[model samples]
Target chain A: MQSIERLVLLGTGLISGSFALALKRARLVKRVVGVGRNIENLERALELGVVDEVSTDAAQAVRGADLVLLGTPVGQMGRLMQQIAPNLPVDCVVTDGGSTKQDVCALFRENLPRHLAMCVPGHPIAGSDLSGASAAQFGLYEGRRVVLTPLPENDLLVVEWVRQLWVSCGATVYEMSAEQHDGIFSAVSHAPHLLSFAYMNSVLDRYNAEQCLDFAASGFRDFTRIAGSHPDMWRDIALANRDSVLGDLKANVAQLNHLIQLLESGRGDELTGFIQRASRARIEWGKPKKG
Target chain B: MQSIERLVLLGTGLISGSFALALKRARLVKRVVGVGRNIENLERALELGVVDEVSTDAAQAVRGADLVLLGTPVGQMGRLMQQIAPNLPVDCVVTDGGSTKQDVCALFRENLPRHLAMCVPGHPIAGSDLSGASAAQFGLYEGRRVVLTPLPENDLLVVEWVRQLWVSCGATVYEMSAEQHDGIFSAVSHAPHLLSFAYMNSVLDRYNAEQCLDFAASGFRDFTRIAGSHPDMWRDIALANRDSVLGDLKANVAQLNHLIQLLESGRGDELTGFIQRASRARIEWGKPKKG
Candidate 1:
């Protein structure tokens, strides 16, 4: 395929930096400009050779760029899109690495309305608790899944190019509508994060929280692992996907209330059945797929 | 340390089997008799040399035993204590690997009234998702923590004997009241498990359950890891530690309700503060501590 002559990364972090590294190894990009608010992170990106150059200016960095990737948190993407809009090349295919997509699709419509045909919204399913340029690795996306939500007005050619580039990075790309993407992710990802945060806060609210934390072992570790996620990014997600996340959170509260009733009334058999169903389903889900 | 002339394991599983293996390796046990309802697990215990002999009769196995470790679920421990009480040597010291100590203490009081002076209820903080006789390892307790709640009627000599044995197995043991042990474990271990189970069940309740599971990534996997735990064992724990577990569940529900109010009102700054506090605390708790 054709090479990306100039690639501008809006945030020099794990997801975007890894993408840039993988594409460079595939010989798919010529020059990369890493832009971020954090000078240290941008410098690290440069030191690691994740980019040909580093810039503190989003607008200046997007000048003459053929592909502009918005990799900042969802809350900041709209502002970045606005900053780069005036200088963006007319035919540059714009995309974002936002976890929640519908809000991003709206950002494109609001800030880059004229560039809708060249815009694609995507989420790369790769993250540990780690973040920033230091966490970037070329193999991060190998065998990982990327979901792309394309606009109706988007050019088919641009969408296909984006898909092919992700494929070149050893990622399996799947296409879905922005609405579906947000709903599915809220169920599997966003709500769980919010729930973890809620659980952590509850534990902290306890009078013996210090004692509780002191004795926390493996179960608490895994259950609350995501409670340590970046706050601003998650705050944006919770608001952006408000309806679905609210639904799931409400459903969880309902489940907890029902469980309380079981415990209070001493319904051992029903309690066992409830636990058995969930345990069986989780075991089934955890099993290796036959195919 | 005087070697245990005979070591009796009431149930051939991870906790008790590993104890036997560790004691054998330390030359602290001259013989180990594994007793269980499941013949296969007992046979596997013998095959793995976790036991010198296997029996389906708890009473017979406890005959002439100097040390008896109750390793089954707390629900089964009562019946096993009653069975072994008929034949246990007068000087034999009894301990348990029950996760909840208060209930096991009550069980000992009710079933082994004559043996209270020799009873010690314990919990070993070592386990993965794995169980069964094959999951036992001599090194399982290495660098791990064990909590022992000794009955007021217990002899200091017997308690010291138990503590030394665990230290030989490479464990650091702590002493606490059964009430304190139950309260702490309910906070850190039992409640998180039920929350996971409740969350999994909530997801399964959704119409798009399969679709949600299809796209579940790392966050969901870690948050729900304990949901796949053995159902009956967890059921017993929840019931056994009902009061503290109920308090935690209720506290979590209150937290979620407040979170829902925040989400419903669209209080972005307040939401950020909530997440920020949780995020900060979790990050702090997850950091490696220095002496």
Candidate 2:
């Protein structure tokens, strides 16, 4: 594979910094520039050797760059794309590490319509509760999956280059439509997060909320762990993937209502059967599988 | 604390075997007789030194025991109580490690009316996903909490003795009404397990369930970990703690409805507020605290 001469990372956080580190370890990039709003984070990125240089001006940072990775929350991608559009090298390949692909694709069309041929939207399957440059690591992408949703106007070579870049970082690449990516993630990732947040809020609404929390044990801890996620980032995800998220959430609500019916009717056998189906499927899914 | 001369553990599994091991470590029990429907489990218990003797006969095992701990599912407690009632000595202090308290209390009153004074219903808050005698460990209760709901007809000294025995095994015991114990556990433990099961089943109900499962990341793994729990065990708990579980499930449904409203209206600010509330409380709950 051809090596990247100048790789620019916008919003240098866990995803971006980790990407930079992985590529550096793989010797795939010559020099990387980190761009972020926070000076402390940019300095930390430089100090940690995640970037060869740091810049606060994304437009200036993208100038003459051959590859640019938008590694921010979905909500922040639009403004960043708009900022660097006029200065982005016409031949530069642009891709994002956004969790939601449809929204990011829309942002690309809205902010960089003329550059759509070089713009690719992607999602890295590796997720963590941790954030910022400090949480980034060299092996964050190893044994992980990355999904790329290429626009109809995208240059096939540009998409292939992005896929090869992720492969160099030790990730298996999967391709799908933007809508399919949104729906799949909504079912497995987005809805579960919203469900956990809702469940936590339910406990908080109880009159004896504090007392309830006092006895909350391992089950509560695992079930509500995602409820401790960064609120702003999740808010962006929930809104960006609204259509798919709403459909999945309503499906979950229907499931809960069905459970209530079984519990209310005192249907022991059916309830056991209901629980068994889920247990079996979850246990099966948790088994070691190929990426 | 006066040591137990003979301890009969009915339904020898993780809780019962762990209790016997903990007692043996503290030199608090002279002998422990394990009783179970599975002869293989009883043999394993004996081999692992979780019990001094093994028995398939509950009534025979309790004949000369000074302390009998009915360590079984709440559903099995009644049958075990009936089996041992005629053989129970008047001086024997009977207790249980059942997860649900109200139902066990009723079982004590129904099957062992004559033994009520010696029957103290208890719940060791040391829950685990692993089961069977092999899962037992000496340190399982080293820092765990035990909630004991003493029967009104129970002798005060017998209750105190039970508390001392748990303390001897390195546990701190709290006294509470059976109703309160049931309600609190429903809020924290039972409801979360059911919620996880429901969420898992919702995914399975989808048209692209397999694809969704393929894309599931760490968030789904943690969120649905409890869904892989022992179905029979959870079924017994959900049914045993029916009223409280029902109330909690309903409250969760109401929470989901409110979240749907927020999502549908595209009220980003209110949705952010909702998720932030849950995230703040969970973060607070997860911090180190004095038990």
Candidate 3:
């Protein structure tokens, strides 16, 4: 087994910083070097001991690194890949923390060297309402799922090494085709966020129309809390995962309209039953243990 | 000003227990008496220091109390109101912690003594995903909104006393008609829950169809966390506030359909822009406190 002692963490925001913390907490990585656009964020990540050192240059951060974790916004991954491709270590296992896989994997294939069979795309299912380095905490990945989409052409040893990295970080590893992973998350993750954002904005618009802030209550607060998450990151996710997102959006709206029609026809029982079914399922899923 | 030395709290669950803790924390009441259906809950309230004493008898708890808080569900409020009406002191100010006001206020008016003109209908706009006495905590109402809807025929002194009570408990008080208050919350609070519940159920159904449990990530977890809250309580809320919830549901679904159309038609910019707008508004609303 290859020892992932030296790790390069690109982007020290919620996802990257959290990956850093998770790695250290699980004793999976001995040294972490963080690279990001924001110097202050890098300083904060270092100050929190999420990383052993920081660098402004992506190439410098990637040098001699055993594992490189790309946690940038999906839209930015392509540009970063092109910039770091030339300097990437020959045998280094490169992985990403992008939520949307299709685009990031496409960029990795387009930009990286042939030896980049070592490139593994990863998406850890963990986060909070907070963002940036300040919100980064250890144990964020404990018991969380981490999905990996490895190219078929990739060496088995490299794939297992990447899986071992995430497994060591306390994340349960699941492997799927990039297309399958993208479609699933588009329906489950990206689509829900789009709806939440749209639903919250719709409520805000109504409140603004009444010229009253009175409508902002506990329900609205809970419903719209995710709306306060990083906008740029979401925008990138939506755009990169456009096809799946569009399909999911269509299905979601159709579902919502079905509920609306039930309400319009005054079918209280049907609506109530529908909500009850969903509530029961959600309860069975159980609360995600707080870190 | 009427002396508020001892406070008597009915229901002793999340709302009542939190109120008890807030009262004690603020030193607004010298003692708190708890009444509930379950002795265990009452004991839990006592254990949490939310009350000085516990009683299963509603009438016994109400007698000689300067302030009596009815924190039962809206559906049960009328029956409980009838039960304690005769035992309530003529001078004791009667208030409730129920969500829906117009219905609860009417119940109070029809059941309580006509001579006791100090009945106040209040809905403290504060709560959590957890419920029952065990979930109650001190300072739950700190910096939160509490809507007080006073009837036209009610004495001003009664309204002011209720206002003073909540003010002393660390809440900013707002006054509105019972009808208006219900309408506003129906659009914001009740409606959001119904939508969230509906969305979550849809996801669960899809998850079942695909035979995929591993696919549910943090996005699904956060999106449906509230779905795990008390089902009976939510069932009552949906039934009692059906009209407004239905109306808001219609509006929300319409808004969702509008975004879906944009995405389906390949207008990625338009779709992403809407989410960005929603995200910005959410951030503005939930901005972290300034130093």
Off by over 4 Å in 2: none
DockQ of each: 0.87, 0.87, 0.39
**Between 1 and 3, whose TM-score is larger?**
1
Query: How does model 1 score on DockQ?
Result: 0.87
Would you list the C-alpha lDDT of every candidate in the order shown? 0.92, 0.92, 0.77
CAPRI tier of model 1: high
TM-score of 3: 0.80
Model 2: residue B140 alpha-carbon error in angstroms: 0.8
- CAPRI-wise, candidate 2 is high
| lDDT per residue as tens, model 3, A158-212 | 8898888678777899999888888778767787788788777767766443423
Q: After superposition, how far is residue A177 of candidate 1 from its true place, in Å?
A: 1.3
TM-score of the candidate numbered 2? 0.98
Report the Cα lDDT for candidate 3: 0.77
- Checking candidate 3 for backbone clashes, the offending pairs are A278-B201
